[model samples]
Target: MSHPALAFSEAEYRVRISRAREQLVARGMDALLCFAQESHYYLTGYDGGGYVFFQCLVLTAEEKPLTLLCRRPDVSQARDTSLIDEIRIWLNAEDTDPANQLRGILSDLGFAGGRVGIELDTYGLTGKNHAAIQAAMDGFCTLVDGSDIVSSLRLVKSETELDYIRKAAALADDAYDSALDTARAGVVDAEVTAAIMTTTLRGGGDVSPAGPLVNSGSRAIYGRGVGGPRPLDAQDLLILEYAGTFRRYNCCIERSISIGGPTEAQRKLHGLVRETLEEMQTAFRPGDTLGTVDDIHRRRLDAAGHAEHRFAACGYSLGATYRPSWMDVPPMIYSGNPLVLEPGMVFFPHVMVGDPETRLAMGLGNTVLVTETGCEVMSRHSLDLPVR
Candidate 1:
């Protein structure tokens, strides 16, 4: 059979699989059942939207080859993108038990009655599916939560990954510029969103799993509001949140703009957000803990008397992500998180503040990569709020 196109060389995949095996052995797990799309792609170069359904990559420390179990429709997808040659198909029939099939593969691979690792916290593994898998493998093996094993390994990116992230960041900057230019009095919110999307795609950005967020006036107060038909008016505040992707790797940015000019109050809020973002950049270093960076931002905002406006988490890891969100795993920048800032770790430090009483909102953020000395702001855009 003819092999499908692959993103990385076969040797790269081999190295990744070898590293995963080492992690499994260290965890005393005979095998790893990866259900997250990011994990499957990281290990096998498999990229598909079929993760909304049930699919898993079974990697074992044994001499046997890895197995990818997916629905029939995604077979070609797996063949096209991944280095996985051993493909197992589960039927769509109601009576068909994919979990049982998974058990058979595990038993065949000599993992029966052994400890197996599963990504229990991922969105790919549904609650019903988890229960079914447990029932199917009841006496055959022991299941342990190894969600962080592969994800942690993915934290530090290689040069190739960094290159893709940089490309994506460039696209994000273009999108931001488009949004700023398109946002003006008498313009519809949807129009601004369209400009951002068009510019991103025209600049070689990949299709995002989630569309860009554009909201104005009252809707702008909510951070995650989607675009609507509301038209911008003079002095209206507009919030834009979007991402750019290259080969599924995402670099996200968020910014706020005023239709005409900002009021003195809005200027104060924007200045506070700008200062917090500056502090975020300065505090992001290899030795600094994730919580330390978050604390720096939080303290600055609290001292500015905008503590109540801040979000629960200031930032999160970013990488190759699918629909619903572009956020990657672990090292959430929040208070009390002990995860250290490591070199090559990319994240988004988003500073947002909203006042319901004043009906004003301001946000400024960019994708940054933690470096040995400090952090590199991947997205190149103005820190000041743009008045269109």
Candidate 2:
């Protein structure tokens, strides 16, 4: 990378290459076809919209320098970012039938009859291009989910990755707090979302060009959007679930505040969730595994008679993104992935308990890092309800 401080350099690139070879060897596979954007960036540091042209890479077990197949424009960018040596260009227009281009590139790379690993979920062309690629690969290559092999390596962060996450968490909290202050009644959810987005940009953060969460009230409770009235009302609880992104890394901080004092029920749930969070943080120390910590959260919920009011996945991984990207916890809190918490990994434990019976939901969260001894939390927000 051009920036000495931010981007990976030649040495780091070699490390990635070594790890790729190791993964291929361990997986008992000889070759791989990676199309996932994150995977692409991880391997090569080439971050462009491959979906536009079906650009992708092929890695061989023979430890050959990686090969990239994409529209002509991406060659230089790829060279700067990825560890690959051969970057092949498609003669066809980027928006045209890219699958044909993919076939040509693959055949030229001698990947004709082998089991080719492909990132199914992340790689693709638009409908037109995808159809063409699908037709071309019909009888040629065997595509499988090669994610596990790569993910096993990516989950462990280096010191550099940790710094980015820490910065991202701070930036997210700053934006989240601003949205909390502006979440008075009569405010639109979109407005709150916009504020967070603007704050990230203004704070010298890389926001990934998209806003985080904007759900108000119940909308905030759902993982996606909270469809409701456009404007909020006094005494209404505006729940905000959002974060700031830095260079594709992201964090999730779920907080809710009342425009005014809370109702009796609201206060109770708020107290419960807040207390839960406090107890959780208070009790957790470094060296706690994912399963152990996840269990503790649930145990407290059970003791409080909230066994059923919890989020499906109460905790998630953190970095320049969320969802599929950040959902990689080793203890399998959500999916039972069983990853040990090393010193560098980070997780945001967010516990949200929703009681539709009272139409009141309360949430508590913190951003934590796994250190050699235990965990260190960087979040300053508390479980108490936020106010203007």
Which candidate number maximizes lDDT?
Answer: 1
lDDT of 2 by residue, 135-236 (tens): 888888765567666555676677777767777778888887778766777777678877888888888777542346465555545555544546776767
Q: How many clashing pairs per prediction, in order?
A: 1, 18
lDDT of 1 by residue, 107-210 (tens): 88888789999998788999999999999999999999999888988898888889989999999888887787788899999998889789978987788767
The whole-model lDDT of each prediction reads 0.86, 0.66
Position 102, candidate 2: lDDT: 70
- TM-score against truth, every candidate: 0.97, 0.84
Instruction: Highest TM-score: give the candidate number.
Output: 1
Candidate 2 similarity to native, TM-score: 0.84
Runs of candidate 1 exceeding 4 Å displacement = 1-4
